[model samples]
Target: MLNFPLWKKLMVGVVLVWSVLAALPNVLTPAQMENMPSFMPSKTINLGLDLQGGAHLVLQVDMETALKQSYEKMEDDVRAALRDRSSGTRINYRGLRSNTETGIHFTVLNPADVPTVKEKLHSALTGVFVLNEGTNIAVAYTPEELTKMRKHALEQTLEILRMRVDEFGVSEPLIQRQGDDRVIIELPGVTDVSRAKDIIGRTAQLTFHLVDESARAGHRLPAGTGVFYELIKDEAGTVLDKVPYFLVKRPALTGENLNNASSAFDQYGNPVVSITFDSRGTRKFGDMTKENVGRRMAIVLDGNVYSAPVLREPILGGKAQISGNFTVTEANDLSTVLRAGALPAPISIIEERTVGPSLGADSIEAGRIAVVYGFIAVLILMAIFYGGFGMAANVALLFNVALILSVMTFLGATLTLPGIAGIVLTIGMAVDANVLIFERIREETQRGLSPMLAIDTGFRSAFLTILDANITTLIAAVVMFGMGSGPIKGFALTLSVGILASMFTAILVTRWQILAWLMRARPKTLKA
Candidate 1:
């Protein structure tokens, strides 16, 4: 155990140098890091939400709106099924409508076509039950199917929220489902709460519809049409007025066909959003514009019309731009949401909290003081009890702390208050292995063995005990990390890394130093 080869010494030297270099960035300022040499380590540990202060939000998903939209889509499918000419027969229908409570309802105009209509609808739609009383029919989702839909919607919303948060460049965000209908989000280092909320909460549902030029605002809207308003905003984004437009109820295209979106500037130096569509959307948009060359097309997002430009010529390149006199920030936000994809359901913020940086600063200071005091006490105790060997243990303990910080920086782990507590505990535990080995060596020396033989026998005997103890603690840390929440996870992560580092420094490093000293001094008597 005391044999130290040239390769082993080189390996230890490299690890010590690399760890110190990596941990150096934690004490340097951002300006100093920027001026650092090109070949040095520069990454630092990330701070948790509690340590850095940020935004906390609880959002509730609007399941009712999601169900209503699902029903409306089913209603359109029913109409298309009845109008299908593949069978060389069209079923006449009337009073076709849909609601969340009643599902889709319609009546066949002719009693003879009731059977044909039911057959066509049953074959066209899946996961739905069709029922009829005489010529009147009702279609609704099965209970099992409804449950699956709700679960899928919630899961999809959670994934989309994660993507949006990632694009926002948050360092260590915590996002998870809270209950059946709510989500909890914590964004670390986010100061602009309003902007974060806007990016997260907006549904960003985009649709395209044709304008009804013949209908006026004061008159009744024509059949198969709906009234939508466009909000006119001032320079500061305050709503100035709303212009109402009559648009076709059925959309020509939706955002599901979008390929990419980005913020850009128009020819007049105004901010805009440029969007590209997939092949399917390109074909549909080209056909719609070609068929209605002289009409106006309205671009709607989240139920409000953003732009309604006249189709003077057909657009066939699968690209379009939306000009809404938006500020640069607004345009960028719109582009981000478009690229992230729309939420399956609308979300409303039910709870919100903003943490200030002052509280974070105070917490950090308190943690630093605790670590320093704990470290100093450990150093004093070890030095007074074991003398030279204790001082060597102290040196190893210092490297152990550096190794912990370097590993965390490399893994991009976030440090919280609980993590600091873990480090303090590690400081006390780091010396336990050295104390055991020293006492074993003293026992062997008292039995009349020589200093070098006593040292080797002590290390060999104590190795198994140290390995067993550290392995059990490491297992507990793994369990905590697997089963605990965000804060507990922070604690477990630091504790686990600290245990591994302590094992290396306490067993390998201290042993190497002691053997090197014995070779130089050639002591006749052992004091440890």
Candidate 2:
């Protein structure tokens, strides 16, 4: 075990050097890291929300809205499917209506049309179960279908939130589904709570609807139409006034048809969002523009009209631009939301808390003080207990610390208060390995074995014991990481990394130091 091969020596040297360099960024300021060369590693361990202090939001997904929207869409499909004249027999229905909780209800005018409509309803909705109540037929989602849809909605909502947060450039944001209909978001170092909430909460549903010029303001919208108030903002984003536009309930093209959206400048150097549509959207948009060549089309986002450009000619390219009175940031954010796609349903923040940087600074300082004092204490004790062997262990312990930081930085792991506690625990465990080895060596020395022989036998004997203990601890860390969340996960991560590093340093690195010492001094007696 004491015989270090050339490759092992080289590996140890390389790892030590690399770890120190990789861990350097963590100790440096943001300005210092930026000043570093591009090729050099400037990435540091990302601090968790607990350590950095940022936005904490608990959002509840509007599942009712999702279910209602689904029912409404199913209603439209049922109408389309039952209205087909190709079946030779006309299927008549009246009093067609959909309720949020009760689903879709429609009565067949003729009892003979019931069987035909039921078939069409089944064909129209994939997961719906249809029930016949004499002349009245009710369509609702099956239990299994509802469960699946709710799960999908939650998953899709999480993904959309992640994309939006990623576009916002949050350093280490945590976006995950909580319960069946809740989402938890943590934005580290995000001080602007209002902006973060605005960006995350906005549905950003963009649709192109034709402007109804005949409809007068203040008059209630007629059936088959809806009113969307367009905001008029001054230089600031605050709404000065709102002008209502009555339009057809159906949109000509929605953002769902968009393939991509990017922020760009218009011909006049004003910021705009350029969008590309998918094939189906291309056909629909092309036909719409061709048919409505002299009409104005309103570009609406979340029921607010950004622009209502007059359709001059057919847009066959599937590409269009949205120009409006927008700042660069606004344009970029809009493009981000468009590209990310709309959330499955609206999300309302049920719980919100803002963590201040002062608390983060205090936490960081406390963590720093604990680590420094604990490390120093460990170093002092290790050097004093086993003398020369203790000094060797101290060297390995230092490398272990550096290796932990390097691994965390490379993996982009978040560091929290519990993570620091894990490191301190690792410091003790690392020394424990050395203590076992040194005690074994002392026993070998008492047996009158030569210093080099005693060292080799001690390490070989201690190897299996060290491996067994560390491996078991490593397994625990793995389980912790897999099962835990947030701070517990952070703790597990650092603990796991520290265990591996400690094993390497204790078994390989410290042995190399002792072997080199033995070879150079040719000691006749062991010192422990």
Q: Best-fitting candidate, measured by lDDT? A: 1
Return the TM-score for candidate 2, rounded to 2 decimals.
0.89
Give a tens-digit lDDT track for model 1, residues 89-146. Answer: 7788889989898799988989998888889889999999999999999999999988
- For 339-415, candidate 2 gives per-residue lDDT tens digits of 88998889899999888988998999999999999999998988778888889999999999999999999998889
Instruction: For each candidate, give its TM-score against the true structure.
Output: 0.88, 0.89
Error of 2 at 46 (Å): 2.8
| Clashes (candidate 2) | 0
Per-residue lDDT value at 444 in model 2: 95
Worst 10 residues of 1 by lDDT: 85-94
